[model samples]
Target: MPRRRPNGVGLEVSALGLGCMGMSQTYGVPDDRESIATIHRALERGCFFFDTAESYGPFVNEELLGRALRGRREEAVIATKFGWEYEGTRRGALNSKPEHIRRVVDECLGRLKTDRIDVLYQHRVDLEVPIEEVAGAVGELIQAGKVLHFGLSEAGAGTIARAHEVCPVALLQTEYSLWERHIEQEILPAIRERGIGLVAYSPLGRGFLTSTALPAEEYPESDYRRHDPRFQGDNFTANTAAASVVREVAARREVTPAQIALAWLLHRGEDIVPIPGTKRRVTLEENLAAVDVVLDAEDLRRLDEALPPEAVAGTRYPEAVMHMNGR
Candidate 1:
């Protein structure tokens, strides 16, 4: 797979990074041994960056990645987030206190079987903790040789500016796809000016863009999609309709809808690196192949016209989950 330089970060990662969230949580049950194999396969295929979060399996995903990268740690760029403090199954909260960041870095270091995190993101903007303080904490980690770079996830423009003032941000990971374009208004321009990269999560819209979303009643009760507004009632119907348009285009082009979506993101900007999640090798390879799909200006214009930002009928997350995002 061919790769491109993203700004001045000086780090070269695969065009499409693998999102490990589904291997441990969100999507469904997963085979640990198989997931590890999948990680190995991804590395063999040139995928150097792996994305995970503290909230993903609350910790399981990190441990899994740690084991998989035990000996090959130096070959991969590991990225994970901190800031969410889950008290119990029913109670979850955000905490980005400087002390909390120090503690989590120590924990992540142990769980990842590495001395330093290549990219340490503040999972989400912790409104309770000043952005300056958050950046300062990561800056200390950098000085201590515990973290190489700092990034933010789902942060607003104001928060990003404040955080960068404390420590230069190398990247900002957030939800951006054909269906989600809120970042285009402010986030993209801010990061572009600062020479920071954008790590796009859910570029496939949680499988909606791939034309595989289950019906409203088919999703498991514990499944996150069950509560997502886009997956419920009429919203899901409307969402599926838009997805069908992409499917039609893919069929006409002799490619998969998933490929079309990922390829579109690739053309969006060289600074954009999308991490599409999957637990099975079949789907993982399918997504990796997206790097080969070529799209022209006309294709992108058609996609942009068909699925405008906010074309999806409902919010990306349900109220409860939405509250936990972007702090």
Candidate 2:
């Protein structure tokens, strides 16, 4: 695998980072043995950028990464986040207090078994706490050598500018792919103008681009897609039809639809790094192979036209939690 730096920051990682959320929860049941093996395989294959969050499993995900990177910590660039206030073991509400940010970094270090975090993201902007304070807190951590870089996830363009004024934001982690182009409207311009790198999560459209997705109701309640509007009824049918464009190109290139989808993201720009999450080594290998897939001018044009922003049917998240994004 090759390497790509998301921004001008000193933090350069694998061209394709591995999203570790699925190993802990969201996608399917926990498979510790296979998940750990996949992590090891990722390192062996030179895909060393690993993404996890403290909010994921509320803490267990960081512990799992810590366990996986015990002896090979030096080979990986670890990125974890903190954003929610917890009630015992359950998440209660959004929290980004300066004191809480400091506390979370220390706790993350303990769980990740590292001296410092490579990139620390707010996860979501806390409306109660100003972003400057949030950036200031992380900036302090950076000065104290507890964090290497500052980042924000799903933040609005204005918030990005405000936070960058307080502390240089090296990266912005958000859901971006052929299917999710909402950020391109304003966030992309803001990030580029500020020289911040982009880490695109769900570059596969939550597995819809894999050509193997089921209806929303088919997924268990534990799975996030079961609630994703794009996976429901008429939306699912229409979205699936639109995705046929990916399959057509894949078949023409003699590759998988996933490979075609990921290749297009890679061609989109050098500043963009898509962290497609998978818990299985087989799937991991398939995704990493996408780095080698080439998309010509024709392929890019067709793909760009296939899933126009208007073509995508439901909102990425449910209305209940939609308020949490782009704050």
Candidate 3:
């Protein structure tokens, strides 16, 4: 397995990480047996970094990851987030109050069946709570040895600086792919300046770049992508066409479009890690193999021209959800 140290933190992880969110909710139904098998496959293949969040499945995703890592926890680098409030399975509101952060960490530790979280992130910028306070709360956890590293998701450049000042942030989890390049203009530079690494989620454009994306209407209402503007109506058609460049490159290189997309992110820098979510062992193997798909300068140029920021169709999220990003 290829190993990478984000921001020179001396914390080494597999070049490709496993995103465990899909196993419990979103995209489709839950399949415990398949998901556990997939996790075992990932470990066998040397892909150990696993990401989940409290809001995912409103709680079940952590439990699922906990169960999967049961006897073999020592071999994995677990990363999970907390920032949202939940009423059973339904999401309620954003809550990152200092007290809430402390309480959530305990609950997450319990759910994950681990004494420490390898990396703990604030899922989103809690506008209700100041970034420094959130950082301080996480800092205390780090001091207490409950979390090994701290991360932020979808935070602005200024917010990242503030949080890092309070507690050195090890990574920033956000959306980045051939179709989404908003961070390149500002956030990327800021993190690079501070020597912080990036954890690129939705690295496959939510599976759209893989040429297997279904139209929004095809998804059940229970699926979160149904409400995502990028998957709806004309936007889906336009985005699919725009992402064809990935397929073109894949055909030329004799690799899957998903591999092409992941390879593009991997080539961006050693500090950047892409966590592509999958519940099937076959897809997991395919995603992990992307580390070997080398895209030369010409291939990189073609991909850049193919999916420029303007080429994408809709906002990454609906209004309410979009409001929470880059805060």
The candidate with the higher TM-score, 1 or 2, is 2
Give per-residue CA lDDT, model 3, range 1-327, as digits (tens).
799998857778899999999998888898989999999999999999999998888788999999999999999999999988877677777899999999999999999999999999999888889999999999999999999999999999999999999999999999999999999999999999999999999999888888688989999998878988999999999988888889999999999999999999999999899999999999998999999998989899999998887888899998876888897
Model 3, which residues run further than 4 Å from truth?
none
Q: What is the C-alpha lDDT of each candidate?
A: 0.85, 0.93, 0.92
For model 3, give the 10-residue run with minimal summed lDDT: 84-93
Q: Model 1, 58-109: lDDT tens per residue?
A: 7888999999998999889899999777666332667899999999899898
What does candidate 2 score on TM? Answer: 0.99
Best prediction by TM-score? 2
Error of 1 at 220 (Å): 0.9
Worst 10 residues of 1 by lDDT: 84-93
Q: By TM-score, is 2 or 3 better?
A: 2
**What lDDT is reached at residue 289 by model 3?**
90
RMSD, one per candidate, in order:
1.6, 0.8, 1.0
Ranking of candidates on TM-score, top first: 2, 3, 1
TM of each candidate vs. truth: 0.96, 0.99, 0.98
lDDT per residue as tens, model 2, 236-296 = 9999999899999999899999998889889988999999999999999999999999988
Considering lDDT, where higher is better, how would the candidates rank from best to worst?
A: 2, 3, 1
